[model samples]
Target: MNPLQKRCLILGASTRAAAQSALYAGYHPVCADLFADTDLCTIAERLPLQNYPDNLVEQATSISPISWMYTGALENSPEIIQAISKHHVLWGNNAEVVQAVRNPQKLYQVLKKHDLTALHLREFNHPPPANSRWMLKPKRSAGGREVTVWNREAESYYAESHNKDKLSTDYYFQQRAEGKNYSALYLASATQTVLIGLSAQLVGCHWLNADNFTWCGNVAPVLFSHQPEKHQKLAIQAEKAGNVIAKEFGLRGLFGIDFILETPFLPSSFPQLFPLEVNPRYVASVELFERAFDVSLLKWHIAACESFEQSQQEEFVTTENYSANFSAKAIQGKAILYANCTFTFPLTIERMPNCADIPSYGRLIQKNEPICTVFATGKTIESCQKDLQERSDEIYDALKIKE
Candidate 1:
C-alpha cells in the first residue's frame, strides 16, 4: 500500500463501480461486498465477510480507521449504516437521513408539501380501482428486488402467505405510472443541488436474463433521437425534482432519482415525470455517466460531503460542467448478465475488455445470479444497446459449456 495515498472504504452488495470511481479520484479503496469479483480484487483490497450485510460491521471494524461510504442495498439498512459510522468517518447520508428518505410515506408527504408532482401511495388495506395499476414495493430494497405488480389475486396470496389480513409495514403499494424509465444523477451541497447526468434505465432486460423489475443496466444521455423537445422537457423536470428532494431531505453528496417519463397520448401534450425512488448514495448508474462524460463522480461526491461538513455553501460541481462534456449523439451503456441456469464459470474472464465484476474461475453461479457486467459505447443508443446485447450473448454461450 502507498503510505501517502488516501484510504477509503466502500461497502455494498457490489462495490466494483464505486471502487473504480474511488481509484479514479486518487484513493486506495478497501472494499467489502458480496461478490468481491476478480476485477475488483485486482484493483483494491477485499475484506471478506462471513455473512453479507449482517457481518458488514464486524468486518469493517477490523480495518484501519478511514472515511467510508456505501453503495447500494446498504442504504436500506440504516441500523447497520449507523453501526459502521461509529468507527469510521461517514461521507454519505447518515442513518436518520436514510430512514427518512427510504420511507415512502415521508417522501410522498414531502413532495406534496413542496407542490411537486409525487407518486401516489396506496394503502395496503385499501385496494385500488379495478382498472388501475399499482406496484407492491418493499420499503427497504435495492436493484428493484422484491418488486411486483399489484393485483387482487396477488394481494390475497400475499396476505395468506404472511398469515395476516394486511400487508406488512415492510412493504407498500405505489400507483403504477406508465412510461419509459429513467434515472438522474445529482450532486448536492448543504445549500444547493445540481443535475449531473440522466440516463435511460434498463429494467428486466431479457437479453441479460433479468426479469421482473430487476435492474439490468443503463444507457446514458437519453437522446430522444428525433424528439429533442421531449428530451429537453424531461431534463428540466428532472433537475427541478432533484433540487426539491435535496432541500427537503438535507441531502449532500451524490444521490440518484429513478423516475418514469410519461409521454401522453396526444403529441402536443408535454410529458410528465413521476419519481419512483430516491437512492441517496453513489448509485450504479453513475458509472455510465463517468464513462460518457469523462468525469470522476466519486471525486465530486467526496468534495460535496467534505464541503457540507465544513459548512461551505458553494456548489461542488455545476450542471454546466457535465453538459459541456456530453456529446449529443454519443451513448454509453452497461448490462449485468444474469445466469439462466446453474453453472461454473469456465474462464478467468477478468482479461476481457469492457467487462467488470468478473467471477473467479470455476465459481458456481446459480440461476438468476449475476455473472458479470458488460459495457459498450456507440454513436447512438440503439447501436450501443446492440453492442451490449452481442456482448451478453457471447458470455451466455460461454456459460453453456462445461470446462
Candidate 2:
C-alpha cells in the first residue's frame, strides 16, 4: 500500500471519538456500524457508511483500510469476523490477539503469566449453584453488556436465553469484578507511540437487574485530579497493557485499553491499577475531542495507516489546552462538546446574528446531539468545567443550538 495512496475506514464509529480522530487525521474516513447517524456521523458529515450482509468482518478486514477500524468488540463479533486469516488487509489488529483477551478464563490465565491481577473467574456450561456468585459474560463482547451476577438457577435460565441475540454457549461465567473503570485512548506503530486522550468514567454496571448496560457518565478528570498521583499511575499501567496486546497482534495504528482501578489486597495502601482488556480501535474520547478541537483525527490516522509512520516531513498541530467533555448528565440527558479549535466557531460566528452576545468564551457553538463535549483549559479544571457548564446550559436551552 503506497503511503500516499492508501485510505482508512473505522468501525464502531458510533461515538464522536473515532469520527473526530479520523476527521482530524485528514481522511473523511468511512464510518461503519449498525447504528447510523450516530454522533460520529453527524459531525463527520461526509464519512462514508457501510452496512454488512452478516459477513462484514471478512469484507471489512480484507483490504488496506487506511487506519484500522476502532470497533469496540471484535471477539464477540464472530459472525462478522469468522473469516479472519493469518493477516488482514485494511488497517486493524491481528484477530487472534483479540480472541485471547475475549475469553474470560483464558484472559485470567494470561493475566497471571503477565504479572497482572484480574477478577476471580470461571466458566460453566451448566447452571450455577445459588450460593455460587459468578458474573457471566459472552466469551467475546464489549460495552459491559449481558454481564450478570452469580446465579444458582443457571441451567433453566440458560436454556431459555441461550441463543438469544448474540449470546452463545461460547459464553463464560466469572465472579463479577467490581471497581472503577476508565479508558485511555492510544495510538501506536512498531516504533512510535502516543497517548492521545483519556475518558473520565465507564458505565456498564448492573445492580438490581443483574444485567447492566448504560453509560454512567461524569467521572471527569476534574474529579479524579483530587488524587492526581494515583490516577497517573493507573493510566501508565493501562497504556502498558494495551501496548503488550498491540504488540502481540502486530498492530500498527490507533486503539484503546479498558481497565479497573481497585483497592489493593493491602487495604491501607492506595488503589492498585489493573489492565482489563484492549479495544484495538478508536474510542469515544477521541470522537469527543474531534468536535471539541475541530481538527480531523482521521487525517493523522490515515497518514499513519498509509505510511506506517507519522510524517517527519510535515508538521503536526494541537490545541494549547482543550478537553472532550460530556458530563452534564445531571442537568441534561446527553452530551455535546462546545470547544474552540484551530478551526470553526470564530470564523463562522460572523455568519450568525447575536452570536457575539452569546457566551462565546471559546465555547464551541455547535450543539446537535445526545452528549455535549466541551473544551476549556483554563488555569483550573473547576474553572474550565464551570465555564463549559454555563455555556452548555445556555446553548442546551436555546432554540438556536437546537437541531
**For each candidate, what TM-score against the reference?**
0.93, 0.62
Scored by lDDT, the top model is 1
Best by TM-score: 1
> Per-residue lDDT of 204-313 in model 2, one digit per residue for the tens?
32211112433333223323556778657666666566666555555556666666667466767767655555666555455444443444555554444455334431
State the lDDT at 127 in candidate 1: 59
Per-residue lDDT for 154 in model 2? 50
* Superposed model 2: Cα runs more than 4 Å off: 1-8, 13-17, 38-70, 73-75, 78-89, 126-133, 152-156, 159-168, 192-198, 204-213, 216-224, 264-267, 289-403
Q: For every candidate structure, what is the RMSD over all alpha carbons to the true structure, in angstroms?
A: 2.6, 9.8
Q: What RMSD value applies to candidate 1?
A: 2.6
Residue 373 CA displacement from its true place in model 1, Å: 0.3
Evaluate candidate 2 by giving its C-alpha RMSD to the native, one decimal.
Answer: 9.8
